[model samples]
Target: MASDPWQGHDAAVLFTVLLTGVPTVVGLAVYLGSRLTRQARRRTTPFRTWRDVSLAAAGAALALYLWGLLHVLFLDGQEQAEECERQRPEGTPALVGRRGDFIPLRLVCEASDGRDYTVVIPGYINPSLTVLLLLALLGGVVSLLLHHKQRTSTRKKG
Candidate 1:
């Protein structure tokens, strides 16, 4: 059996997954719960609307990020290995190894002879994640500001 590349990093990966996954699950639950509970309510308040949109956007961003991570963790190394094997000269014997980076989420194949080839992720993933995160942040801020204004207005009228 092949040894797991992520063996020692299980805890860190699990923590990272949960950090993103929890929000995703929560957002899904909130969406479903609201839908089920408010079947008759066609009109949504600004705060609720913004809050839901923010949660959904955040969830989407996290989910995409998670997908990218999983792709790197599982698929990238194997693919890179194959590419390295194909690139090696017929008579040369060189071992191919993987190196990973988490912060920027990258993997590279290192041949024994000091040559390195980077594993490529899909082009759209990072840019899409960035846009979604920005939308989520904007929505959250608007939601919070609207909620505060509503509360203050109520207090003044009461």
Candidate 2:
């Protein structure tokens, strides 16, 4: 039996995955959004200043990062990694069967402090996303809403 029974919990897995990836993803969005704004300005500005050129370059880099971020967010990752030390299971020098084949998962703690645990990140990964995944997905979709706002503002000013 594995100590970290909660290892396969979907929500935990998804959160861990996204949380790990967010920094890079956000950086890309910023980089791209900045560049995009710059490029738009360049089309209107004949001065062709370094500022516009720089913005365009930045935007390109940002877009590249954004793409990379999305690729990472959608990437396949393991469901869970339960830390054995947290559980403090007893007896084995090294726990058996940390890797390969679906073994039984039992959350056995000893009667006293009982059995601790061994960390297990199952090799098999399920492609299901949890509520966190859904929220992240929703946020991604809702970001499109900003386009309407930008258009509305541009219309009023123009």
Candidate 3:
């Protein structure tokens, strides 16, 4: 067990919002903006199916999601280090590097009150959901590409 400056449940919620909600909103904006640009270029409205609508949205959402996950998993150490620096109680010796080959970036510190603490700071996402989201994104992209090809070939033939 690692000491978290944030409450566990609160951390989970913050991670969800940071990793999912913000990106989803931004993705939606980009998706709609691209659609509008395509429509303007073609001078016509493009057909959209329920599946296409859902899948495209899903793809955008998932792509942004994976980016956020990567940041949390691999690029958030600096933020955590900053947190440890800002939050550690005063006069605690400089945080020592974690031992072992598999340890996450962390600081082992002893407080002035003589209590030992392991400040294991890291961002998190659910692995299972990440896998599922990736698969769905792949499927969505394949389906969309096939759909576009079919439409273009039909337009050429007609």
Give the candidate number with the greatest lDDT: 1
- For 1-158, candidate 3 gives per-residue lDDT tens digits of 25543222234543665667666756666765665575554753233443345555565545554444444344244554555567777666665432111123223343435554544433342343455456556666666776788789999999
Q: Which residue runs does candidate 1 get wrong by more than 4 Å?
A: 1-23, 26-33, 36-43, 76-78, 83-98, 108-118
Against the hidden true structure, what lDDT does model 3 obtain? Answer: 0.49
Off by over 4 Å in 2: 1-48, 79-158
How do the predictions measure up, each by TM-score?
0.65, 0.24, 0.30
lDDT of 2 by residue, 29-131 (tens): 5654665675665664222333343444443433333333333234232321234334444454442222221122222222233334323332221112233
lDDT string for model 1 (67-122, tens) is 76666556443565665566655555465465555555555556567765545455
Candidate 1 RMSD to the real structure = 5.7
Question: In model 1, what is the error at residue 133, expressed in angstroms?
Answer: 0.7
Ranking 2 against 3 by TM-score, winner = 3
Q: Considering TM-score, which of the candidate structures 1 and 2 is the better prediction for this target? A: 1
Local accuracy by lDDT, each model: 0.67, 0.39, 0.49
